[model samples]
Target: MDSVREQLQIFVRRFGLLNATCCEACCGEDVSLVQSHILFEIRRMGEPSMQQVAEELGIDVTTFSRQVKAMEGDGLVTRRPSERDRRVSLLGLTDEGRRVLVRIDRYMAEKIGQIFSVMTPFEREVTTRSLALFNEALAKVGEAASDGKNIACCN
Candidate 1:
């Protein structure tokens, strides 16, 4: 198998290209890539704590906390005490964040549709079915749940 760095680099490169054509147009800034990723996932998952995002993305709590703070400064995302757990801060997309999320999601869906248009009927069917397996496997295995507190990485 190839190295993990190789896999990550490929994923990041493709992500940059995807955002350049879709997210960048709506956000008007290339640096918004990571912010969009965080905002999109949080919206989809409902209001997760900053710790949950850091856990899911394999980032340090301090790092994601700073990033969320910057987004708050920009008025794109919001933080509030969780009703169920007052000690934890629930991070959610503000109205501005929602607007950009919808736009970027639609753009990427269109981009994927365009890409799949080139595939043969059988290849398309196979690829489409395989995607279900991918999600199924991860849903059964990979989780990014919040613990309301920081956990040591690789512990």
Candidate 2:
């Protein structure tokens, strides 16, 4: 059997997480994979603050701000001062940005459907459950590490 690291590396590459130019069929001609994710998160979260989206994506505030500025220039995103907190900047997508996001979503859903079509129902069920478990396990590990405890779990 392949080592877990080897399998995960292959999975990540296949999922295009490491691709610089990941989305092109979705108006990603000018956007990098990271930028695409930022746009996606902004749209998904419905006008979150600049800091909120940056933290969700695990990007540094400075770098995220730069990317947001670039996207704003491209007319894909807009930032306005928060009414509740004047010091905060709330982010939103333009009409074109929403269209691009929809294209990206449709493309991704089609790809997932193609892959799921080949899997047996049982296999699909197990795979979905396993991925959810994996995410939960990773979140626990992350929380432990953030709290300055490095407890190892082997299962």
Candidate 3:
């Protein structure tokens, strides 16, 4: 059996590639950079600033700022002054972003379905259990990084 750490690295790298490829096929040129900006900062969370995206990704603010500017050109994301705080521009996914995200979701779902199709029901059940364990372990790691704080899990 693979160690948890090894499997984690493989899972992240593989899924990360899948997402990147989907984004590249959906968008173009700077697709991965633009998609990362959305996937990490906007798609799942409420609108966040270019600054916030930079902080979360451990990148320089200027890098994400320029990336956001490029995405704005492609209509992937929008930046408008927040109603609550005019100084902080709210960064959000545009309709184009939402469409692309949905396509990516479908692509991933189809790919995952193909993987599961070869498995027996018992194998599927075991995979679900393994994923649950992986999630629990990831939550613990996230907590350790942020003083036991964790993200909300709808699941």
Give all candidates' CA lDDT scores.
Answer: 0.73, 0.83, 0.70
For candidate 1, the per-residue lDDT at 55 reads 76
Q: Per-residue CA lDDT of candidate 2, range 73-150, in tens?
A: 988899999999999999999997787778788888988888899999999999999999987887787677754233
The lDDT of model 3 is 0.70
Candidate 1 off by > 4 Å? 2-22, 25-31, 132-155
Q: How close is candidate 2 to the true structure, as a TM-score?
A: 0.87
Residues 1-155 of candidate 1 have per-residue lDDT tens digits of 46855964686576564454445664454336667778877987798988788777666888788889998887779999988889999998888877777777877788778878999989989978987986676555544535422233332
Ranking by TM-score: 2, 1, 3
Q: What is the lDDT of candidate 2?
A: 0.83
Pairing residues by index, what is the TM-score of model 1? 0.70
Q: Per model, state how many residue pairs clash.
A: 0, 0, 0
Q: How far is candidate 3 from the true structure (C-alpha RMSD, Å)?
A: 5.6
The stretch of ten residues in a row with the least summed lDDT in candidate 3 is 146-155
Better of 1 and 3 by TM-score: 1
